[model samples]
Target: MPIQTRLFVRFALGYLLLGLVAGVVMAVDPAWRFLWPTYLHVIVVGWLTQLIFGVAFWLFPRASRDRKRGREGFIWATLVLLNVGLVLRILAEPFDLGRAAGPLLMASALCHLGAAVGFTANIWPRMGSGR
Candidate 1:
């Protein structure tokens, strides 16, 4: 597997653990329920989505003999943006409900959007394209 794939999968596993811990904390103390959204994103976007991306990157058809896995830079950008967005969201969501952290939340959303676009752009060419 590519190093990028490994990084993404590893991060996904870490996020899964983080999400589980967050869920348990919320379960033990309902007061921590404000983190519900954060927990969901961590599990869904951080774990599930990243895992899917990593696997797809590894399994997808090669764009060419010289360039497999599409674009390395885009993959790296996707990984970075996704994690940055998730981290930003986690840190900013529980603070003042975005009254003070509104920009941060917006930036996080943009980062996620960028990640999605980057992943799509990188993978689209490789989809169904023979090796």
Candidate 2:
């Protein structure tokens, strides 16, 4: 699998583990104060968000097809920053310092966003309406 695909799979597994653990926690201690929110942040921001981004970047039209300058760097940086940010978020949330993870995640999002835009630009020319 491509690195991007690997990243997506890892992110998915991360979320699944978090969910299973959350379920157990809920079952054991339904009165936990931060159950839902904590889980939401991790699963949504840390997991699903990363998962979607990785998949989008991996499968995005022209993502792998284009070998132009800086494309690989952008994609790899996206993978690194996304996972690093997610890890930071996961660590920060439990200690009530989740804000610490915000910047990293934002940077990661920007990288992925740039990659998506680049991919779109690369493929757009090939997608004409037969004009």
Candidate 3:
């Protein structure tokens, strides 16, 4: 598997573990129920979506003989943006850090959007007929 694929898969697994732990904590302490959004984001965006992205990137048809996958830079950017955005969200979401957190959360949302765009741009051409 490509390094990017491995990185994505590993990160996804880590997020899954983190989400499960968070869920357990919330179950144990009703006070932590406020973190439901954080746990959901970790599980869905960080784990499930990332896993799908990685596997799809790997399983998708190649772009060409010379360039098997699409642009490497885009893939890298997608990985970085996704992981950074998720980390930022994990830090800012449940803390209620007021104004500072608002910007961080916005930035995180942008990063995630960028990741989606990057992934789409990189993978679109590969979705064609493998002539």
**For each candidate, what TM-score against the reference?**
0.94, 0.60, 0.96
User: By TM-score, highest first, what's the ranking?
Assistant: 3, 1, 2
- How many clashes in each structure? 0, 0, 0
What is the number of residue pairs that collide in model 1?
0
Candidate 2, position 7, lDDT:
70
Off by over 4 Å in 2: 63-70, 96-131
Instruction: For model 2, give the 10-residue run with minimal summed lDDT.
Output: 61-70
Question: Which segments of model 1 are wrong by more than 4 Å?
Answer: 97-100, 129-131
Query: Which scores greater on TM-score, model 1 or model 2?
Result: 1
Tens digits of lDDT, candidate 1, 1-131? 99999999999999999999999999999999999999999999999999999999899889889997788899999999999999999999976753759889999999999999999999998876445
| CA lDDT for candidate 1 | 0.93
Deviation from native of the Cα of residue 24 in model 2, angstroms: 2.6
Candidate 3 lDDT by residue in tens digits, 11-111? 99999999999999999999999899999999999999999989988999998899999888999999999999999999999997888999999999999
Alpha-carbon RMSD to native, per candidate: 1.9, 5.0, 1.3
Tens digits of per-residue lDDT, candidate 2, 90-117, equal 5654455555666755654565465455
lDDT of candidate 2? 0.59
lDDT of each: 0.93, 0.59, 0.94
